[model samples]
Target: MARTATAAAAPRAPGFLRAALLLLLLVAACRQAAEENVVTELRCQCLETMKGIHPRYIQSVKVTSPGPHCDRTEVIATLKNGQKVCLNPESPLVKKILDKLLNNEKWN
Candidate 1:
């Protein structure tokens, strides 16, 4: 009876401590995610702000949402110099532009 009680007591203390540590880690991750995203309202659509760029200087492209009422899947072109531009991917002209940039082909 004494040995059984000692073993049970030892495991329970460590088990509770591990659970507490895991809970703390999960809370920290949630807080960090919430802080990283701050949304604002935009009066205009995303495509209205599109600009032209030379394919040679573009490094990569990705999708991001800037605000509500604007297109959610708006494409962001990242230049080699760390500058970024918003683009409307649904347009035929923009598609041609991205294809030219990604394929490393001359834009005619």
Candidate 2:
């Protein structure tokens, strides 16, 4: 009886740890997905805003949303010349334009 009880408790300990790890992984994945969504939305907005002025200037786009101290969003555009331009979503100029282009009801 003592041995059987110890065996049952051993299995339960690993099962509980596995469950906790799975939950932590799931939370991390959800946070990453949310950040990616925000970046995608911002990139689309930037592309649309730049379309008229630059036409085909933007060759590629990369977005980074760093943690607390850094800005919430950073968008890097690769130009035809292999040069890159970084745009901070927190910047005044970027915020103004994005607000006009993305959040405005007129664009819809």
Candidate 3:
């Protein structure tokens, strides 16, 4: 009777572990999707905010990964004047400041 009980329990252990692992994987995927959406949104907003600037001074806008995780995406702007600015999406204040610097009407 003891040997039969152990055999049944052994099969159940693997099933429970697999279910837990699958749940964890699903949660991770959802989190990654959300992070990607946030990055896309931030990129679009940066572009719109900088559109008023002179086209001649704006060379390119690109998304760069600052780290392993996609949570900290840097929006890099290259200027015709040989200047580059990296904007961090993690900080609202920094974004506001960068917007003013890059899109100011007085900036050449």
Candidate 4:
């Protein structure tokens, strides 16, 4: 009787664990999607608040241009703390840092 009871519970244990893990993964995916949307909205409004790179916080950058002119370019930076900022892609300082990132240079 005892052996039969343990065997029945063993099969259900694995299934229960799998269901719990899947639910956790689903929750994480939803959280990330919502955070990305927030980042996009904040980045769009960066022109008013962001003046330059928070050097210590910068994680990566993306460049976009409204026209052929460099002056029209926008550099969107995703910071280490998950904040995003938009700055002039034409700036020499920004260009240097961007070049380092793009070139895959080793950190000093």
Give the winner by TM-score. 4
Model 4 agreement with the true structure over 1-85: per-residue lDDT tens digits: 9999999999999999999999999999999998986554322333542456746678777876554333355778898989777
Query: Can you write out model 3's per-residue Cα lDDT over 1-108, one digit (the tens) per residue?
Result: 999999999999999999999999999999999898666444333332332334456566566664544445566667788776655555565465456656764433
Ranking by lDDT: 4, 1, 3, 2
Q: Poorest 10 consecutive residues of model 3 by lDDT?
A: 43-52
- State each model's CA lDDT, in order: 0.71, 0.59, 0.62, 0.72
**Residue 61 shift from truth in candidate 1, angstroms:** 0.8
TM-score of each: 0.43, 0.36, 0.41, 0.45
* Weakest ten-residue segment in model 2 by summed lDDT: 44-53
Clashing pairs in 2: none
Off by over 4 Å in 1: 1-48, 64-71, 90-92, 101-108
Per-residue lDDT tens digits of candidate 1, residues 1-108?
999999889989989999999999999989977876774334433545465566667778775554565546677778899987777677676788877767878756
RMSD of 4: 11.1
Per residue, candidate 2 scores C-alpha lDDT tens digits across 1-108 of: 999999889989989999999999999999999898656443233332232214155465565665553435566667788877766555565555455544543422
Which residue pairs collide in model 4, if any?
none
- Scored against the true structure, residue 10 in model 3 reaches a CA lDDT of 99
Instruction: Spell out the clash pairs found in candidate 1.
Output: none
The per-prediction tally of clashing pairs is 0, 0, 0, 0
Ranking by TM-score: 4, 1, 3, 2
